[model samples]
Target: MTTTPDAGLRQDRHLATEIPGPLSQALMARKDTAVARGVGTTMPVFAARAAGGVVEDVDGNVLIDLGSGIAVTTVGASAPRVVEAVEQQVREFTHTCFMVTPYEGYVAVAEQLNRLTPGTHEKRSVLFNSGAEAVENAVKIARAATGRSAVVAFDHAYHGRTNLTMALTAKAKPYKHGFGPFAPEVYRAPLSYPFRDGPDVDGGAAARRAIEVIEKQVGPENLAALVIEPIQGEGGFIVPAAGFLPALQEWCRDNGVVFIADEVQTGFARTGAMFASEHEGLVPDLLVSAKGIADGLPLAAVTGRAEIMDAAHAGGLGGTYGGNPLACAAALATIETITADGMIERAREIEALALARLERLRDADPRIGDVRGRGAMLAVELVDPATGAPDAELARSVAAAAHAQGVIVLVCGTYGNVLRFLPPLAISDAQLEDAFDVLAATFTELS
Candidate 1:
C-alpha cells in the first residue's frame, strides 16, 4: 500500500526504488490509457507532494528537483506564505470572473507588476491564465497601439503553443509540427547566439544584422512589435550578447516598433534580478511574465506603458478566469516572499555554486561544449568532443541516468543537446552540491 509523507516534505534525496518505481509505473500505465498522447511528461515518476527542493514521488523517492517544474516554483512548490494566501483566498472565494465582478486581488497583482517591472513610467497590466495568453494579449495591444499587423520574433525562440504564438515561434518539430495554417504576418529574425556565432560577431554586429533584415524585409512601418525572450526559455537558455538587447531596443525605439520582453522564464528573480531586463537596464514598451509569478499558480500578465496598454479598447482584453482570486492572493504572497526572504540574493548564490561546479566539469570533460546562463538558470551544451557536433543521444542518456539516480534535470534547446538546470531558490546549498555531485558522477560514468 502507498503511504503519504509528513506534512512537511523532507528536503533530501532518497531513491526507494528505480526512477519509476512500481507505484509510479502503475500510475503511468493508467495515465497512458486515460490521458492524450499529445500531453507529454518529462519524468514518468508521479509526484505525491513537493516542498523546498525535493519532490516525493508516489514510490516514496524524494528526488532533488533542479527543473522546478519548468521554473514555475521559484519560491518552492509549497511556500508557506503562498500556501497561506491561497488557502485564505480559496475560502473567501474562488472565482467571480474579474470581467463580470471585479475583485481587489486582481487589481493588487496588476499594481505589484507595474511597480516591480523595470520602468518607473506610468504603466498598466492585464492578467491572463498562461504565458501564451499573455503573449497573445501583448501582440493585440501592440497592433492596436501601432495600427500595424506585422510582428517579428527571433530564431530559436519559443513564444507559446497557441495559434498566434505558434506562428511567432521559430521551432518546427514538436510545437508547430502537424499544426498547419498558422496565423499570418509573423516574421523570424536571427538571434545573438554567442556559442554558435563565435566571439567575432559581437552583440552590436548581431543587432545590426537583425536590424538590416527587419528594415529590408519586414520594414519598420509594417512591424507592430518586436517580441523576444530576454533569455530564451524553450529554445535553450540562450542569453543574448552584452550589447545585443540594448541596441535592438534602441532600434525599436527609433522605428516606433513596440519592444516586448517575454520574461516568462527569466522574470521573478530567476536570473538573480527581479527581471532579466534589469541586467541591461532595458525598459521595454511591454513586459510579459508568468511561470514564477504566483509560485506555481496558473497566472500570467502583460505589463506595459499606460499609453500602449490603454490603446486596447475596454473589454477587448480579458478572459473568464483571467485572474482567479486564489492566484492573485498567491502572487501577492509570492512577491512578498521573494522580496522579504531575499530570494534574489538566494538566486545569486545558486548561480555562484552552480557555475563553479559546471565550469569545473567543463574543464575536465570535452563533451561539455559550453556552460552558460545566469542565476539559478544554467545549462551545459553537450557535444561530440571529436567532431564538435551536437550529441542528442548523449543528452538523452545523461538525463535518463540522472533520473535513474533520483536527481531531476531537464534537456532542451533547438538541437536537443542542452541539459538545463533551473533549481528553486529554496533549495539549500548542500542539496545543490549533492545534485552536482550526482551529475558529475553520472557524466564520469557515461564517459
Candidate 2:
C-alpha cells in the first residue's frame, strides 16, 4: 500500500484568529490543568493539520516545518505512502501482538532492518515501540551476551528517559534531574566535541581517552557494551570525526564489550547515508533504530550480530505493541520509500542548501559559532559576541522570532545554544530556500 513521495499537498492558510486563537487558549488552560506539569513546550503552537513540509496550526497559521517532529517524519508529514499504509493496515487489524500472533509484516520489517543497517555479517533484529525501548533492549542483549553488568556511555550523550538510559544520558537538567536511583554500573566519559573540547583534539585522541577511562574506571573486561550515537541528536547534532567511530569499534573488539550504535535519530537516511553509522563504514555490534522507521507510528528496532542477539532466553526481547501490524506495515512502506524513492539523495541536497546558508551566517557573524552536521541533520551553535560564551538566549530568541514569522525551528544542545535543522528529506528546494531566507532574516533582526 506504500505509494511514492508526492507533493500533491497544497498549502492553505486561514487566520481569522490569533496565533493560538481563542479555542487553543481554552484548550491550553485545560491542558495546563490536566497535562503533566513537567512537560516541555515547543512554541506552544497547536497543530490542526500538517502535510509535506507545512504544518497548519489550530489558529490557521501555516508554518514551514524544519524540525520534522524531532527528526521522525523524514519522508514528510502525512506522506501518501505512510497514510495509505497506516490506513490499510488499520483496516485489516491494528494489533496482533507479534509475540502472541506472529505476522509477516513484522518479520518483513525485521528482515529489512537487518539488511539495511550497517554491516554484511549475519544479523538478527527485534522490534519495539520506542527508541528508548530499543536502546534498553540492546543493553539487555549485550549484558546477556557478555555476562557483564557494566555499561559505558559518553558525556553530552542523550539516550532516553528510561531509568537505565537516563543513567547513560549525560545531560543533567530535564532528562536526568531528580530522576535517580539511576541504574548502577553505568560510567560516563568525555566524548570528542571538536568545536569546544579543543580544535587540536580529534576523534582518535578522544577515543583513546575514553578507552583509558573505561579500562581504569570500569575495567574493560567487565564492561558489557559501549553505547553511543554516531551523530549525537539531543546533545546537538555533534557528528564525531571520521576516525572516532572506527576507533571505538576497534576498541570494543580488542576488549570484550559490545559496540551499540544508538541511531534512533540518525537512522533511516537522516544523515544522507542509510544509517549514520554507515557514514564511517563501521558496523556496530547492536544498532537501535526508530523515529523515522514508521513515518510517525510508534516503532523501533534493535539489529545486531546474530550471536549477540540470540544470546538471551528466547522471549527476552519484545513488547505487546513492539511490532504492531500497523506499525510494521508502515515501516515496510517507510523503508521502501527511503531506499527506493531517492530520499537519501534528497537528504544530501538539503544539507547542501542548509550548509550554504549556515556558512554565510558564519562568515557574516561571529555570533554564529559553528555550523556542523551531515545531510539534513544540521545545526548552528550560537555564542556570545565578546566573551564567546554560549549565547543560549539568542538561540531561543531566534527560534521564537522565526515562529512569529510563520517558520518553526527547533533549538537544542548541551549548552542550549544550537539551532538544529532536521527537515523532512522530501521537502522541496523552494521550501528549503524559504526556510534559509527566514533564518537569515532572523539573524539580521537579532543582530
Candidate 3:
C-alpha cells in the first residue's frame, strides 16, 4: 500500500543469504501447508518494509516497485497527508459500523464522490468495503431501479471473484473454475480490443456481435443493465476502439438499460483522467469506484444518478464497515491530495514518459510485439516474431531478469504474454529512467 513519498527511496541491503532466503522459505512452507493458495500470485518476494515505489524484501533486496500495490497506492507509500488523516481517524475511532451508528466521515466521502463522479445532474453515493462490493451494489441498484434481470459484460473483463461478479467477469481459470452455478442472468460478449482487431473488427461490428448475442440469448427487453470498464484492467489493459463505448451507451439508453461503468481499476486519476469513461465523454447510470479510492484503505463506492440509486430500499444498501471512519478519512485526504497536487496532470506526464521508453524498447526488441496503454497504466506485449505468436516464456524471462536486477514488473493478458507497468504517479523521473535502464538491461541480458 502507498500514501505519499515520506522519504526519498532508500535501499539498504544487508543480505545474509539468497533472495527470499532461509527465513522466507520457512514462512512459505508453513503458509502453503496451512493456508489456501487460491488467490493468484504475482511475485514470490515477501515484503519487510515498503514506502514510495520501493519494496524491501526479507533478504534485504530493495526492489523498485512497478505494480503500485495493484493500483492502490497512488499518492505514494507513507504519504504524510494520508498517514496523518489515518492516524487521526484511528485515534478517534476505527469502526462503529456505519450501518449501526452513522458517522459524518462516511457522509463526507459520499458527498465528495457525488460531486466528482461525472455528470452535473444530482447524484448520490454509497460506500462498500471492496471493488467487488461496489460492483455488486451497482448491479443491485440497476436491477432494483429497472426492475429487470439480465447483465451484459464484455469479453476479457475482470470484475471480481464474488459469485455475482464472477458471473460478471469473463475469464474462467481462477475466477470460475470450481465456482460453478454462478449467479444467473449474466451474459458475456466480445470486447473491442484494438491491438487484436482487424478489418472486420470495427466498433459497429463488435457492438453488433454483442447485441446479436443479447438478442438471441437474453432479450434486451429483459436486460436490466450493461456493465463495462472503459479501459479494461486485468483483461490486458485493452483500450476500446474510439467509438465503441459511445455506441454501446446509445444502445443501452435506447433499450432502457442501466449503463454501469466499472472504474474500480481506472478511476481516481490513474488513467490520466478522473475516469477512463471521460476519455469518450460517456456518462453512466452508475459508476463503481475502489482500489485507489481510500489510498489503500478498504473503501469503495457506487456513485451515480440519484433516481437510479434511490430505487433500493432503505435497508438494501448497508454494510458493517461499509463506510468505516478511517477509510473515509483516507478517502478525503487522498481526494484532496490528488486534486490539490495536480496529480492528474502528473499522471499524464508519467504516461507520456513511460510510453516513450516502452516504444523505444518495442522498436529495439523484435520479440516485443506491441507497446500500448494510456497514462501511467501501460504495457508491452511479447510475441515470437517468427509466427506472431504469444511468447509467454519471453515475458517470464524478461520479468525474472528485471526482478533479479532490483526492479519489479507485472505480466497480464489471456495468454500471459503482456508485461504491464503501473508505478505510482509520485515516482521520480530519475526512477523512471532507472526502471527503463533496468528493463533495457534485462532485455539485453535475456537476448
- Name the top TM-score candidate: 1
Against the hidden true structure, what lDDT does model 1 obtain? 0.94
lDDT of 3 by residue, 1-447 (tens): 444454544733233455656666776777788878784456666778777667777776677778888888877766668889999999998889988888999999989988888889999999999999889999999999999989999888999989999999887876789988999989887888877776678877877777788778888889999999998888888888778888889988898999999999899889899888898898888999998888788999999999999999999997887988998999999898898888899889999888989889888988888887787788888888888788989988988777767777887787778898888777777778888888998888888
Between prediction 1 and prediction 3, which has the larger lDDT? 1
Query: Residue by residue across 170-233, what tens digits does model 1's lDDT show?
Result: 8898999999799999998999999989989999999999999999989999999999999989
* Candidates, ranked, lDDT: 1, 2, 3
Which number leads on lDDT? Answer: 1
What lDDT score goes with residue 245 in model 1? 99
Stretches > 4 Å off in candidate 3: 1-4, 8-18
Give the TM-scores of the predictions, in the order they appear: 0.98, 0.97, 0.95
CA lDDT of every candidate: 0.94, 0.87, 0.84
Q: Supply candidate 3's per-residue lDDT for 235.
A: 81
Location of the lowest summed lDDT over 10 successive residues in candidate 2: 4-13
> Model 1, stretches more than 4 Å misplaced?
1-7
Candidates in order: C-alpha RMSD to true structure: 2.8, 1.7, 2.3
* RMSD of model 1 against the true structure: 2.8
